[model samples]
Target: MQEIKERFKELRKELKLNQSEFGKRLAVSKDVISNIEIGRVQPKTLLIDAICDTFKVNKDWLVNGSGNMFNDSKENVELEELLYKISKENSSLYPTVLKLSQLDSESLVLIDSLLDKILKK
Candidate 1:
């Protein structure tokens, strides 16, 4: 079994969250996240449950590294669900959504900046 602290750090990194952001989601201070990541403190069951519930993390993976990180089927289906919903309710928006999904990361950033400017106007 992996050490819980190391697993926690891995989970946070995989989620692309910095300590402060991760801690905010867990209702803990950044210092608490730092301590947990560095093995200075062992998380109690409450915190463990919070992590699993809040992020849809697989408890087995977080605790024992035994399974996929995200256990919830909803996580896996999010994009598909979004596309389906948009196609069903907003046919005009569905093509745009598909185009956005296919954008490269750099192009996506440029699009985001353009969208921000347009939204601010």
Candidate 2:
């Protein structure tokens, strides 16, 4: 559990997010993040799931520290961070990204095909 807490803080630092920013993404308070990081409070399963889902964290690595920290490449993580910023400002691209993220593999393949045709690429 202590190791998991440390990994939680490490993941936040790797994402270049402060406690408050990280908490905001997880819908938690900064104090909750602080307490968990300091081993003062045990992190709940729901909070863990939120962290993993929001940041694409590997649950195995977050809980047992066995695999890579992130399920996606660092580039994907950076893109997600950018999307978060865009969402805060209510950018048109934010909704597009949100919708794109929810698409299934088949839909994504269709979208890719359409994009390649439209772009002549």
Candidate 3:
């Protein structure tokens, strides 16, 4: 419980978001976030799911602090961080990156195959 509160604060910091901003991203109020962080309130499952989806946070780590913070492979995390940096440096790429992120695994594999063929040519 205390660990969850502490990790909640840590996750918000890792995302570079203030409580208000983090709450806005989660469609929650700042007070709600603050309460959860202070262990005055427990987050609901829906909020937890939203947190995981919006920030690519790991459910297990967020719930129990049992694993890596991000819900991604190491390589994927590196790539995501790179893309995040790029989006910050070049805002124009943000939309493209967002669209790319919405692709399913099969679509990603197809894109990867196409890119590999192009690179090999």
Candidate 4:
């Protein structure tokens, strides 16, 4: 079986975020990340959202440590799931939507147009 902590350490290095920075984003201390990475603690399922959110990690990749780090998507299904999970984990996303809401009517309209374009893929 692939060890999650090892996978996490590998991916973290790939993202170029030091443990302190990554833990800060995940709302945990660097020691927490270090503990997990060093096999001092095993992460739980609830941490999944936080982990994925902070790292922009592929959940399937983290959970199973299998397949491409990137998953192939068809029908926008994967993207929709990714967005929903990310939005759920990050409360700031609501503020992001609100910030986008501040855009003028034409800009907001263009944003919607862009989303429609993506969804149509």
Note each model's CA RMSD in angstroms: 10.6, 4.4, 5.7, 8.6
Error of 4 at 43 (Å): 0.9
Give residue 117's error in model 2 in angstroms: 19
lDDT per residue for candidate 4 within 30-58, as digits (tens), equals 99999999989988777767776544567
Q: Any runs in candidate 4 off by more than 4 Å, and if so which? A: 70-121
Look at candidate 1 and tell me the lDDT of residue 46: 93
TM-score of model 1 vs. true structure: 0.60
Stronger candidate by lDDT (3 vs 4): 3
Off by over 4 Å in 1: 73-121
Question: Where is model 3 more than 4 Å wrong at Cα?
Answer: 73-121
Q: Between prediction 2 and prediction 3, which has the larger lDDT? A: 2
Q: Could you tell me every candidate's TM-score relative to the true structure?
A: 0.60, 0.75, 0.63, 0.55
Tens digit of lDDT per residue, candidate 3, span 1-121?
Answer: 4489999999888767799988987899999999999999999999999988867889999999897898766567457657867987899999987887899999999999998999998
Clashes of 2: 0
Better of 1 and 2 by TM-score: 2
lDDT of 2 by residue, 1-121 (tens): 4498899899999999999999988888999999999999989999999988888999999999888999999899999788878887877777688799999999999999999999994
Model 1 accuracy (lDDT, Cα): 0.84
Give the per-residue Cα lDDT of candidate 1 at 3.
89
1-121 in candidate 1: lDDT tens per residue?
A: 5788999998888766799988987899999999988999998889999998877789988888887878777455355445655787889997798799899999999999999999999
Q: Residue 4 in model 4: shift from native, Å?
A: 0.6
RMSD of candidate 3 to the truth, in angstroms, is 5.7
Query: What's the best-to-worst order under lDDT?
Result: 2, 3, 1, 4
Worst 10 residues of 3 by lDDT: 72-81
